[model samples]
Target: MKLPEINTATPYAGLSPDLVLDAVSHCGLWPDGRLLALNSYENRVWQVGLEETAPVIAKFYRPGRWSDAAIEEEHAFALELAAAELPVVAPLVFDGQTLRQHEGFRYALTPRRGGRAPSLESTTQLEWLGRLIARIHSVGSRQPFVHRGRVDRATLMQAPMQAVLASTLLPASLQANYRSAAQRLDDAVAMRLEAIGPVRQLRLHGDCHPGNVLWTDEGPHFVDLDDARMGPAVQDLWMLAGDERALNALLDGYTQMREFDDTERALIPALRAMRQMHYAGWIAARWHDPAFPAAFPFAAESRWWEQHIADLHELADGL
Candidate 1:
């Protein structure tokens, strides 16, 4: 049967179940049933349900946004993360390989993992999420487990700035529907970008914006491992540090998973700055979209960057 469509994409506009099922049949992991819903987040994400069989997720890599090798790496990372036995989204393999080429793009299959997104107001549940982050960071980087090969902090800081500059120079809105907010936001991100600095680098959930997360029975279950990269432990903490209770609660919660000292606790600022920089970059990149908010999309206002900078009365606070 024809599969449901995947949403949020420009690349997979031509994809259908023909190439997908054809490829899956060859790989031997095709679920023996009809289609379900289209994943609004994944351009290639589709739900396949079979007769009395477990549901499985199918995804195809859209061209341009990602290369075959990158998708290949993502699937491999999911497999390794699964083997590490962390409560993570595990990828199902075909012919022992997680990624395969289909419809002129790459594709992979993984079991349908279930979980709800934790409510922002649920302090206890949020703390539980923190504990999960600590556990992920605790896993020492092993071969084939490094989040991303080249996404270090310095690199992290540059991307958002570039996207902002590009946004600023773009042509004006149509029919004179001027976007004052977008233009002002472009400036805010530009001013905020330079003040960011280094943090305690480790493995980061590269894009930890709240949307990619989920709430599971065990606690918080992280999804969309697309941007998982090697960077700082605090990288995950940046967007989270604004709420003091959540911040402190997370620090306390992490200990349940692994050990960190006062020195590490103090590193929250630098890590947060890096996160803001990336966030500012994202706003700048998508400023053209009407949904893009002027006061930064996911985190606090740009002034938070300045406030963070001023909070430092002394030299860099951590080792």
Candidate 2:
């Protein structure tokens, strides 16, 4: 269950402006300022520009880590959304192979959006967001792991939670809460995963967290479809529920797009817990990976999830 921990900071820790500029030049692109690198759990992204007027981003991925199928899937999803008139960062031309392997590392290029990343700061805007959510969900659900079939919720939760429960390198409080929360929701979790309900799985911008959203003149532009997968309609909703006020605001806009039915509504709290628990567990298992920061946002999310688990349980039992 444990994977090698990576030094999440290694990519940016020693990034000097001169060195980044050098990388820009090496890539045959003019460096307007310096290459801005953003490293996350799975990928490395850098913003480089050929012109001072507007910057284009090129994301260099770790070679062989993401399968060619996944890259293709993401491209398809981005184009799908774009075709619907959604303003997402368009995919620019790339190297013949998306899996750029060199020095045991991989990389790729994708266009950067013109405007800034979207803020979850407004409620009224969320109503607009809800509409987007509805449109996204309505697109057509295709199973992520298996490309040939329609994806249902059961297929999504089954493996991830099993892997999550196996992770151990978590903080004591967070780990404790995870175990406790799992124990409390055992039945509902099992039922949800086992009974297998109707989930309108369409392509999703899998990791639709605030970090992946781009704010533009047109509206919200979804940037990272890396986590794109076939899953539940409100899976994104639970992820956004990390903050209640923002959740409410986004829901207001999202509902205007397509409202959550009563069952989907009731499952929100549990789904929120599911997202945190899954990621928390994943982080714990790899806490010691050389690629990770000894202390990273995963640990922070674990702590938050543990506390929220208790609160959600109290509310659930009361109901």
Candidate 3:
């Protein structure tokens, strides 16, 4: 399927320091004149200091990425998870509204929660996270997201493949290799998914990588539902599992709350491949965004594309 061309124009060019401060002020919060930019490339996230209280995190959505309804679905999911006593950082409802707009930029505020990355090496931590995720799935299974996306070939694999092909960064010489590798990976993914038939799909903490998980003395708390969508339960688990031991540990905790379909294990390899394709495509699609080029300078190098193509082939073979 032909996808829309990536927007090459700089979308955040007009998001000045004054505009950020003014946006916060418009939300009825007095800024203390201290704004620390968070490590986010997809959206503009800032730790905004307040006059008397702890700083709050203000996130400005990327232009044209998600519709208002889709974003609201994300916010609603976070709020639902928080209300269930889960440690999800939900957007604050100001004037009975979680989604707000200022000067054409949509944004939201959430109270800042600080913590370091979770120790994935520790079995205890993985099991703990497993239980938390199972509980999240329990709530998520109650209903479906009306506006969010699904984890599938078209979105994760095909769309990304198109993005990479469309980008000028992929050297003309390497284009054929990249295309062949991507196609093989896509076919392999489709075959694997087809063999699995159908499985349960539910709301998920779509981007459940360690970076999105913060750990304190208490336990793990999930943040950044920006990629939250509908998918198999394993979509939330595979990224956190590094090896057989970690996967077992997570499942041990997970089974305590929800009965996982053992068949979902087969989807992991395919999902991993899809994620790889998606990452390259994401960088390509967002290359026009100034931060992407600066953060992923390697993507501009021909050598990087060569390695990526080789990796795609390897992944396809593994599948």
RMSD (Å) of each candidate, 1 decimal: 7.8, 5.9, 3.5
Clashing pairs in 1: 116-215, 117-215, 160-281, 201-232, 202-231, 202-232
Q: Where does candidate 3 stray beyond 4 Å?
A: 1-8
Better of 1 and 2 by lDDT: 2
TM-score of each: 0.67, 0.69, 0.97
Of candidate 1, the 10-residue stretch with the lowest lDDT total is 310-319
Instruction: Identify the leading candidate in terms of lDDT.
Output: 3
Candidate 1 runs further than 4 Å off:
1-10, 30-33, 37-42, 67-69, 140-157, 164-169, 172-199, 240-242, 261-319
Best by TM-score: 3
Q: For residue 53, what is the lDDT in candidate 1?
A: 64
The candidates, ranked best first by TM-score, are 3, 2, 1
Per-residue alpha-carbon lDDT of model 3 for 1-319, expressed as tens digits?
A: 3322334388778778788899889989899999899999999999999999889999999878999999999999999999999999999998999998887788999999989998889988998999999999999999999898899999999999999999999999998999999999999999999999999999999999999999988887999999999999999999999998999999999998899999999999999998999999999999988899899999999999999999999999998
lDDT of each: 0.56, 0.57, 0.92
Model 1 earns a TM-score of 0.67
The better-scoring model by lDDT among 2 and 3 is: 3
* Residues 1-319, model 1: lDDT tens digits: 3334443333455566666666666666545657765654334577776446687777765445555566666666656656777667766766677876654666677777777655766667667767877867765344433425544444544665456445642233311211333233334433433344443455555566566676666655566667766665655654554577776776677777876554545445445544545555566555443335443443334444334333321112221
Give the Cα error of residue 136 in candidate 2, in Å. 2.8
